[model samples]
Target: MSSSEPRPESGPTVPSVLTWGTWAAVVLVAAQLVLGILMLSGSWSLIEAHAGLGYAGTLAAVLAAVSAVVWKRRGGSAGVMAHAVAMPVLMIIQIGLGSAGVKWVHVVLGVLILIGLIGLPMSLRSARRQSL
Candidate 1:
Protein backbone atom coordinates (compact mmCIF):
# COMPACT_ATOMS: atom_id res chain seq x y z
CA MET A 1 0.00 0.00 0.00
CA SER A 2 1.32 3.44 -0.89
CA SER A 3 0.60 6.69 0.94
CA SER A 4 -1.04 8.04 -2.18
CA GLU A 5 -3.45 5.11 -2.36
CA PRO A 6 -6.70 5.45 -0.43
CA ARG A 7 -7.75 2.87 2.16
CA PRO A 8 -10.98 0.92 2.12
CA GLU A 9 -14.00 2.57 3.70
CA SER A 10 -14.15 1.80 7.42
CA GLY A 11 -17.57 1.11 8.91
CA PRO A 12 -19.23 3.21 11.59
CA THR A 13 -17.26 3.46 14.82
CA VAL A 14 -20.27 2.91 17.06
CA PRO A 15 -22.77 0.06 17.08
CA SER A 16 -26.40 0.95 16.25
CA VAL A 17 -27.60 0.28 19.78
CA LEU A 18 -24.72 2.30 21.27
CA THR A 19 -23.97 2.70 24.99
CA TRP A 20 -27.40 3.95 25.93
CA GLY A 21 -29.10 0.87 24.56
CA THR A 22 -26.77 -1.44 26.41
CA TRP A 23 -27.32 0.55 29.57
CA ALA A 24 -31.03 0.32 29.03
CA ALA A 25 -30.78 -3.45 28.81
CA VAL A 26 -28.81 -3.52 32.01
CA VAL A 27 -31.26 -1.25 33.75
CA LEU A 28 -34.14 -3.38 32.55
CA VAL A 29 -32.73 -6.48 34.14
CA ALA A 30 -32.03 -4.78 37.44
CA ALA A 31 -35.38 -3.07 37.47
CA GLN A 32 -37.19 -6.32 36.79
CA LEU A 33 -35.43 -7.96 39.71
CA VAL A 34 -36.39 -5.08 41.92
CA LEU A 35 -39.97 -5.21 40.74
CA GLY A 36 -40.14 -8.89 41.47
CA ILE A 37 -38.85 -8.25 44.95
CA LEU A 38 -41.42 -5.52 45.42
CA MET A 39 -44.18 -7.89 44.42
CA LEU A 40 -42.95 -10.52 46.83
CA SER A 41 -42.69 -8.02 49.64
CA GLY A 42 -46.15 -6.60 48.92
CA SER A 43 -44.57 -3.18 48.59
CA TRP A 44 -45.97 -3.14 45.10
CA SER A 45 -49.12 -4.57 43.58
CA LEU A 46 -49.04 -7.33 40.98
CA ILE A 47 -50.16 -4.85 38.35
CA GLU A 48 -47.37 -2.46 39.32
CA ALA A 49 -44.83 -5.23 39.22
CA HIS A 50 -46.12 -6.30 35.86
CA ALA A 51 -45.94 -2.77 34.56
CA GLY A 52 -42.43 -2.25 35.82
CA LEU A 53 -41.26 -5.52 34.34
CA GLY A 54 -42.98 -4.69 31.11
CA TYR A 55 -41.19 -1.37 30.95
CA ALA A 56 -37.85 -3.07 31.39
CA GLY A 57 -38.69 -5.68 28.78
CA THR A 58 -39.67 -2.92 26.38
CA LEU A 59 -36.30 -1.30 26.95
CA ALA A 60 -34.54 -4.53 26.10
CA ALA A 61 -36.62 -4.87 22.96
CA VAL A 62 -35.64 -1.37 21.97
CA LEU A 63 -32.00 -2.19 22.51
CA ALA A 64 -32.32 -5.22 20.29
CA ALA A 65 -34.12 -3.18 17.65
CA VAL A 66 -31.43 -0.53 17.81
CA SER A 67 -28.76 -3.16 17.53
CA ALA A 68 -30.41 -4.53 14.45
CA VAL A 69 -30.79 -1.07 12.98
CA VAL A 70 -27.17 -0.30 13.71
CA TRP A 71 -26.12 -3.53 12.07
CA LYS A 72 -28.18 -2.66 9.04
CA ARG A 73 -26.81 0.87 9.01
CA ARG A 74 -23.22 -0.36 9.08
CA GLY A 75 -23.71 -3.52 7.09
CA GLY A 76 -22.42 -5.46 10.04
CA SER A 77 -22.88 -9.12 10.92
CA ALA A 78 -25.55 -11.83 11.18
CA GLY A 79 -25.30 -11.81 14.97
CA VAL A 80 -26.74 -8.34 15.10
CA MET A 81 -29.48 -9.49 12.80
CA ALA A 82 -30.24 -12.28 15.28
CA HIS A 83 -30.35 -9.78 18.13
CA ALA A 84 -32.83 -7.75 16.19
CA VAL A 85 -35.20 -10.69 15.78
CA ALA A 86 -34.79 -12.34 19.15
CA MET A 87 -35.10 -9.24 21.28
CA PRO A 88 -38.52 -8.30 20.00
CA VAL A 89 -39.79 -11.83 20.30
CA LEU A 90 -38.71 -11.93 23.89
CA MET A 91 -40.19 -8.50 24.51
CA ILE A 92 -43.53 -9.52 23.08
CA ILE A 93 -43.62 -12.54 25.32
CA GLN A 94 -42.61 -10.40 28.26
CA ILE A 95 -45.31 -7.82 27.57
CA GLY A 96 -48.00 -10.39 27.01
CA LEU A 97 -47.31 -11.88 30.40
CA GLY A 98 -47.38 -8.46 31.99
CA SER A 99 -50.63 -7.51 30.35
CA ALA A 100 -52.29 -10.86 30.92
CA GLY A 101 -51.07 -10.74 34.52
CA VAL A 102 -50.00 -14.32 34.48
CA LYS A 103 -47.78 -15.42 37.33
CA TRP A 104 -45.72 -18.13 35.67
CA VAL A 105 -45.32 -16.26 32.39
CA HIS A 106 -44.12 -13.20 34.24
CA VAL A 107 -41.59 -15.25 36.16
CA VAL A 108 -40.40 -17.11 33.10
CA LEU A 109 -40.15 -14.00 30.98
CA GLY A 110 -38.37 -12.18 33.75
CA VAL A 111 -35.81 -14.97 33.87
CA LEU A 112 -35.43 -14.94 30.11
CA ILE A 113 -35.01 -11.20 30.01
CA LEU A 114 -32.37 -11.39 32.71
CA ILE A 115 -30.56 -14.01 30.68
CA GLY A 116 -30.85 -11.71 27.67
CA LEU A 117 -29.30 -8.87 29.62
CA ILE A 118 -26.36 -11.08 30.54
CA GLY A 119 -26.04 -12.55 27.09
CA LEU A 120 -26.31 -9.30 25.15
CA PRO A 121 -22.86 -7.99 26.10
CA MET A 122 -21.27 -11.27 25.20
CA SER A 123 -23.19 -11.32 21.96
CA LEU A 124 -22.11 -7.78 21.11
CA ARG A 125 -18.50 -8.62 21.87
CA SER A 126 -18.74 -11.58 19.54
CA ALA A 127 -20.38 -9.46 16.87
CA ARG A 128 -17.65 -6.86 17.18
CA ARG A 129 -15.00 -9.49 16.76
CA GLN A 130 -16.72 -11.01 13.76
CA SER A 131 -17.18 -7.58 12.21
CA LEU A 132 -13.49 -6.90 12.66
Candidate 2:
Protein backbone atom coordinates (compact mmCIF):
# COMPACT_ATOMS: atom_id res chain seq x y z
CA MET A 1 0.00 0.00 0.00
CA SER A 2 2.51 2.59 -1.10
CA SER A 3 1.54 6.13 -2.07
CA SER A 4 2.79 5.43 -5.58
CA GLU A 5 0.62 2.32 -5.92
CA PRO A 6 -2.82 2.64 -7.36
CA ARG A 7 -5.93 1.75 -5.36
CA PRO A 8 -8.43 -0.70 -6.84
CA GLU A 9 -11.06 1.31 -8.65
CA SER A 10 -14.74 0.83 -7.81
CA GLY A 11 -16.63 0.69 -11.05
CA PRO A 12 -18.72 -1.38 -13.38
CA THR A 13 -17.58 -4.80 -14.53
CA VAL A 14 -18.96 -7.75 -16.48
CA PRO A 15 -21.02 -9.03 -13.58
CA SER A 16 -22.06 -5.53 -12.54
CA VAL A 17 -23.63 -5.16 -15.96
CA LEU A 18 -26.59 -6.94 -14.34
CA THR A 19 -27.21 -3.88 -12.23
CA TRP A 20 -27.31 -1.75 -15.36
CA GLY A 21 -29.79 -4.12 -16.95
CA THR A 22 -31.93 -4.08 -13.83
CA TRP A 23 -31.89 -0.31 -13.83
CA ALA A 24 -32.98 -0.27 -17.46
CA ALA A 25 -35.83 -2.64 -16.73
CA VAL A 26 -36.87 -0.56 -13.74
CA VAL A 27 -36.97 2.56 -15.88
CA LEU A 28 -39.00 0.87 -18.58
CA VAL A 29 -41.52 -0.46 -16.05
CA ALA A 30 -41.77 2.87 -14.27
CA ALA A 31 -42.38 4.65 -17.56
CA GLN A 32 -45.12 2.19 -18.49
CA LEU A 33 -46.76 2.63 -15.10
CA VAL A 34 -46.66 6.41 -15.42
CA LEU A 35 -48.12 6.21 -18.89
CA GLY A 36 -50.88 3.91 -17.69
CA ILE A 37 -51.71 6.26 -14.84
CA LEU A 38 -51.95 9.11 -17.34
CA MET A 39 -54.13 7.00 -19.58
CA LEU A 40 -56.49 6.44 -16.68
CA SER A 41 -56.58 10.17 -16.14
CA GLY A 42 -58.23 10.46 -19.59
CA SER A 43 -55.64 13.00 -20.55
CA TRP A 44 -53.28 10.68 -22.39
CA SER A 45 -53.11 7.50 -24.40
CA LEU A 46 -50.17 5.12 -24.42
CA ILE A 47 -51.50 1.59 -24.16
CA GLU A 48 -49.60 0.48 -27.24
CA ALA A 49 -46.41 2.09 -26.04
CA HIS A 50 -46.79 0.56 -22.61
CA ALA A 51 -47.36 -2.90 -24.07
CA GLY A 52 -44.31 -2.56 -26.30
CA LEU A 53 -42.10 -1.50 -23.42
CA GLY A 54 -42.99 -4.68 -21.56
CA TYR A 55 -40.84 -6.66 -23.97
CA ALA A 56 -37.90 -4.38 -23.34
CA GLY A 57 -38.24 -4.87 -19.61
CA THR A 58 -38.42 -8.62 -20.15
CA LEU A 59 -35.22 -8.56 -22.16
CA ALA A 60 -33.45 -6.52 -19.53
CA ALA A 61 -34.54 -8.93 -16.84
CA VAL A 62 -33.08 -11.82 -18.79
CA LEU A 63 -29.79 -10.00 -19.10
CA ALA A 64 -29.83 -9.21 -15.42
CA ALA A 65 -30.27 -12.88 -14.57
CA VAL A 66 -27.42 -13.81 -16.86
CA SER A 67 -25.28 -11.19 -15.25
CA ALA A 68 -26.08 -12.65 -11.87
CA VAL A 69 -24.92 -16.04 -13.12
CA VAL A 70 -21.70 -14.46 -14.31
CA TRP A 71 -21.25 -12.79 -10.95
CA LYS A 72 -21.73 -16.05 -9.08
CA ARG A 73 -19.39 -17.95 -11.39
CA ARG A 74 -16.80 -15.27 -10.85
CA GLY A 75 -17.10 -15.74 -7.09
CA GLY A 76 -18.64 -12.36 -6.50
CA SER A 77 -21.66 -12.83 -4.24
CA ALA A 78 -24.43 -15.36 -3.73
CA GLY A 79 -26.40 -13.22 -1.34
CA VAL A 80 -28.08 -11.16 -4.02
CA MET A 81 -28.20 -13.85 -6.65
CA ALA A 82 -31.77 -14.97 -5.86
CA HIS A 83 -33.10 -11.44 -6.13
CA ALA A 84 -31.38 -10.99 -9.49
CA VAL A 85 -32.78 -14.26 -10.74
CA ALA A 86 -36.31 -13.45 -9.60
CA MET A 87 -36.63 -10.35 -11.80
CA PRO A 88 -37.29 -12.16 -15.04
CA VAL A 89 -39.54 -14.74 -13.43
CA LEU A 90 -41.66 -12.04 -11.94
CA MET A 91 -41.84 -10.23 -15.28
CA ILE A 92 -42.89 -13.39 -17.06
CA ILE A 93 -45.70 -13.91 -14.58
CA GLN A 94 -46.73 -10.31 -14.92
CA ILE A 95 -46.88 -10.74 -18.68
CA GLY A 96 -49.14 -13.74 -18.31
CA LEU A 97 -51.43 -11.93 -15.93
CA GLY A 98 -51.65 -9.01 -18.31
CA SER A 99 -52.41 -11.22 -21.25
CA ALA A 100 -55.09 -13.15 -19.41
CA GLY A 101 -56.89 -9.92 -18.52
CA VAL A 102 -56.68 -10.76 -14.87
CA LYS A 103 -56.69 -7.19 -13.68
CA TRP A 104 -56.24 -7.96 -10.00
CA VAL A 105 -53.48 -10.45 -10.60
CA HIS A 106 -51.86 -8.22 -13.16
CA VAL A 107 -51.89 -5.24 -10.83
CA VAL A 108 -50.57 -7.25 -7.91
CA LEU A 109 -47.83 -8.81 -10.03
CA GLY A 110 -46.83 -5.45 -11.41
CA VAL A 111 -46.42 -4.05 -7.94
CA LEU A 112 -44.43 -7.08 -6.88
CA ILE A 113 -42.26 -6.90 -9.97
CA LEU A 114 -41.57 -3.23 -9.42
CA ILE A 115 -40.56 -3.91 -5.87
CA GLY A 116 -38.20 -6.66 -6.96
CA LEU A 117 -36.84 -4.62 -9.86
CA ILE A 118 -36.03 -1.75 -7.53
CA GLY A 119 -34.60 -4.04 -4.89
CA LEU A 120 -32.38 -5.96 -7.30
CA PRO A 121 -30.28 -2.90 -8.13
CA MET A 122 -30.01 -1.91 -4.51
CA SER A 123 -28.83 -5.44 -3.65
CA LEU A 124 -26.33 -5.22 -6.48
CA ARG A 125 -24.95 -2.00 -5.05
CA SER A 126 -24.79 -3.58 -1.64
CA ALA A 127 -22.97 -6.59 -3.01
CA ARG A 128 -20.44 -4.36 -4.70
CA ARG A 129 -19.91 -2.35 -1.55
CA GLN A 130 -19.45 -5.50 0.55
CA SER A 131 -16.70 -7.07 -1.48
CA LEU A 132 -16.41 -10.81 -1.11
RMSD (Cα, Å) for all candidates, in order, is 4.0, 3.9
TM-score leader: 2
Q: Using Cα atoms with residue i matched to residue i, what is each candidate's TM-score against the true structure?
A: 0.71, 0.82
- Clashing residue pairs in all predictions, respectively, total 1, 0
Report how far residue 86 has shifted in candidate 1, in Å: 1.3
Lowest-lDDT window of 10 residues in candidate 2? 5-14
TM-score of decoy 1: 0.71
Q: Cα lDDT of model 1 overall?
A: 0.64
Q: Tens-digit lDDT track for model 2 on 1-132? A: 764433455333336478788899999998877776676677445767877888898899899888888777766567677777878888888888877888677776787788878888778777766552
**Candidate 1 — which residues are off by over 4 angstroms?**
1-16, 46-50
